[model samples]
Target chain A: MENLYDVVIIGAGPAGLAAGLYSARAKMKTLILEKDKAGGQIVTTNEVANYPGSIDDATGPSLVARMVEQAESFGAERKKDEIVKVELQDKIKVVTGEKDVYKAKVVIIATGASPRYLGVPGERELTGKGVSYCATCDADFFTDLEVYVIGGGDTAVEEAMYLTKFARKVTVVHRRDELRAAKSIREKAFNNEKMAFIWDSVVEEIKGDGIVEKLVLKNKKTGEITEIDAPEEDGTFGIFPFVGYIPKSELFKDFLETDKGGYLITDPDMKTAVPGVFAAGDIRHKSLRQVVTAVADGAIAAVQAEKYIENTFEN
Target chain B: MVILEKDNFEEEVLNSKGLVIVDFWSDGCEPCKALMPEVEALAEKYEGKVKFCKLNITKARRLAISQRVMGLPTILLYKDGAKIEEVTKDEAKAANIEAMIEKHI
Candidate 1:
């Protein structure tokens, strides 16, 4: 009973923190576990304009800090523990973390997702050396230097514009001729003085000595080859890829019902296939993954979890 | 927590007994600041079992360079003073760090 709780939410992102706010406010013995920092993907973001009623000068870190404060105010106990395993077949579920074991009547999985890599050669070796996934975190490193951005989505186009503030020029390389981003975003990128485009192409390899010096590109359609090398005077350049994200749902892969993309499958109410288990946020199978949708999922899951506890344990 | 420097890294971490975690960090890195809270909590939680130390690269560039640490917020897990595992980039989170340390202890 030392580590027992009425509800345990896994993750501390927008979804998990919102669930914690509701779960603890309902007076349930709630605990939220975040293996990494509490903010999840939002921590790496720079601008956050879509969130309704967001504060002035709202940034990813600022918004996450406010969400954490809200959850804490509701008395949700937060901990930093990496959960290694779980047991949810019985009436009471058990979770094993690196530090200790925790038991709970209901469990919410909101672990969210992370950026996906192209898995090409030298991508791993040159990361943090010149290749970066987040322009917000590493754009300053590329000041007055040339940069290459991969992907054609809204995030890619938007981040390309953001990178223009520091990089002297940013060339977006995509596998398709047209961008998949919204019209407004595409227009913004097109209008940017520093933005350039390389269509129907993908990166083959990245190379450098102690840093990123050059990139090898392949034209998918024609099978032609091209390369971009750093200026001799500069010695190195930057490459940012906003390819996409992959769900972080490996922990429950064996038990939870996931989609073809490996996102957790849940009912409209956020209840998973399991009787006492639920999933929410970007980790759950959904059409759109955004802060608003994630927060909505969190609220629903916590309410459903509260109902499950009352119906199963109290009655 | 112990402050790591070129002069004391050998005596304080290398010569020490049991598992030790040497965290390499810089001042301007946002991730390093975000992780400090959890580091304090974990060090307290594992007080008697493991030793935690930190080295600011600006202050101890020689020690950091010798380890081949190319990024900020890099964590090296040492068992009885030898490097066993290193975490950087996305893998350098609180949970992964704890799990790696648990392996050594």
Candidate 2:
């Protein structure tokens, strides 16, 4: 194959970047392809307290920037291109992007997940007006305004707490009576003075002119409908949804084995059922989806890829 | 792209006699930071035909709200001082922004 790379990693997130760094440092020709931006969902996060050994007040963009620098410094070529097709059944994997095609001995699928939407009416039109998925990005715009968060998971409750720092009041609207978040997170949310909850409810519709003005809610347990309007003076309130994530595995579904949730199924070494192909990060069916675990998966995938190449091709 | 300020916004964007794009952004916004380079590259690509400007909402909050841009990374397309179109948040990708530019230009 002409201009063949030793390894080609999809999605320049933490996992892909780490894989690039390791592979390039091992004298393997590596290329990292990203669709939109280098940083994945983590870029929308403001504080990264969970990642060990991180500097005080480390933000997501800063961490991802350092990772990119490390990867590039190790001679991994990174490009901005969205992959449209992949041929993994052959000895040399073929990856087709919107702009170009690539051939590689090893391919890493690190395309991560995106925030799932409520799919209610007007939700799409009102996005970035008064509806947001990233609290760190849009919370400051709602200062002193009432805000509603939709979801009961750790992300939802934690983001609701983050909203309390800026908004006048924060209310959680969940489909169930009890939150699915951890006990520690739920305890902090209950103790917060500005925090409130609407149990057994889901958003029916989002109403607005040019910005969010009202939200209609329906109780699942009781069939009662409630309308919440923005304050007359503020004229608008914020709605943040953190329900769940949908993995970006549509392109790989036909070629790779995936779980029920559409996440790629991989072994302990991040190898997929197909040879010369691997999956990592939140896109893979894994328990923990943190930055720490993602980078660890990337390192392991790269090392395993090296072994696979040596045994199969170098002979 | 020109760094738009409150003082020059009216002169540069409102009074400018062509297609203008103003990227409304803030400090804590990661998407805004990420989209900046792409917008700048577009600016360079359409340098002679289109005018590109960026406004930091952190500095000009009231200006941004007055224009009804209540979010970060809001890309607004204007023609002859009239606001024509806008794409925000998830829709504010490089491809979409380029399509908008191609549509207006």
Candidate 3:
């Protein structure tokens, strides 16, 4: 087939782009298919301090741009198409996108995760009105207003801190008494005067009329419920949820074996159970999900794919 | 696509006749910036049939809120000066916006 590729990676995030850089540099005809524009979830993130070897104040989009440039320089072709189906059992995989179908000797699945919603009432109806997942995207809308952040993880704390810059008061509501974020981030959150915490609590419901007007919070341990109404002057408050993520594995769930959390199961070398099919980045079942680890997974998956192609496809 | 300011928003979108799509964006929103070219391409495709305009929320905060746009990268489809549909955040993908345009136009 004219569209046949040595390796067709299924995303343009950190892992897929890094895989492109590696596999293409190895002289493989690599193609990276992305549903959206490049950068994935990282693009929504503002700061990326923990990425090693990054220069001072490296932003997520800047880092992804460099990665995209490097991958393209190495001759990795990219396309913007959402894959609707995948036939992975055969020797030659057939990936069907909305625009076209592609054949590949080796397929790297790098479809990443998306922000998990709180699933509380009114969250769906008022998503654009007041509830948001991307702080960098919506912070400016809440300038000088009160904002509530949902979650206690790294992203939740970091985003809550970021919201403090725009919102008058930023409060983090966690189901646990203590935060699950890193020590340094926890210390920073504790020290910020504008930041506050609602421990052992979860949002029971978000109430609004045309916009976010009130939030009903329930304490997990004490069984106490409290309702916070929007300030009369402002008429609305912002609710940001950074709780967790849901892997974008809906397309491959039937063909691939995923963990309980829907993360694809992969060996140490990023090889999935299916031959010639590998999974990497946030989609893979791993202990840590970070940019550094995702890039490492991508590099390993590419190298392993090359080895697999040499042994199995060469005849 | 017409870049709208507070002064001419009504003239360009609300008061305009037929179908109109407004891209609610800002300088700091990365997705909004990334989706710009795609939106512009759509504008070129549907040139005379649909009116496409972009508003920077940073410069027109009150106007954006008045239109009930509280999030970034929001695409609102207006028919006869009334908002018929909207997609925001992750739903504001190029394919989805294109589908929205096709459905209304």
Return the top candidate by TM-score.
3
Ranking by DockQ: 3, 2, 1
- What is the DockQ (computed on Cα atoms) for candidate 1? 0.21
Which residue pairs in candidate 2 collide? none
- B30-56: candidate 2 lDDT, tens digit per residue: 778878998999899989998999998
Q: Residue by residue across A199-302, what tens digits does model 2's lDDT show? A: 99999999999889999999998999999999999888999999999999999998789999999999999999998999889999999898999999999999
- Second chain of candidate 2: TM-score? 0.97
Error of model 3, residue A66, in angstroms: 0.4
Model 3 C-alpha lDDT per residue in residues A79-183, reported as the tens digit of each score: 988899999888899999999999999999999999998898999999989998888888888999999999999999999998999999999999999999999
Which ten residues in a row are the worst by lDDT in model 3 chain A? A35-44
Question: Per-residue CA lDDT of candidate 1, range A129-244, in tens?
Answer: 78888676566666788999999998898888988997899999999999999998898899999999999999999998757889999999999999888998767788888899
Off by over 4 Å in 2: none
Q: Categorize the docking of model 1.
A: incorrect
Worst 10-residue lDDT window, candidate 3 chain B: B26-35
Pairs with steric clashes in candidate 3: none
Candidate 3, lDDT over the whole model = 0.93
TM-scores of chain B, in order = 0.93, 0.97, 0.97
Between candidates 2 and 3, the lDDT winner: 3
- Residue A230 in model 3: lDDT: 97
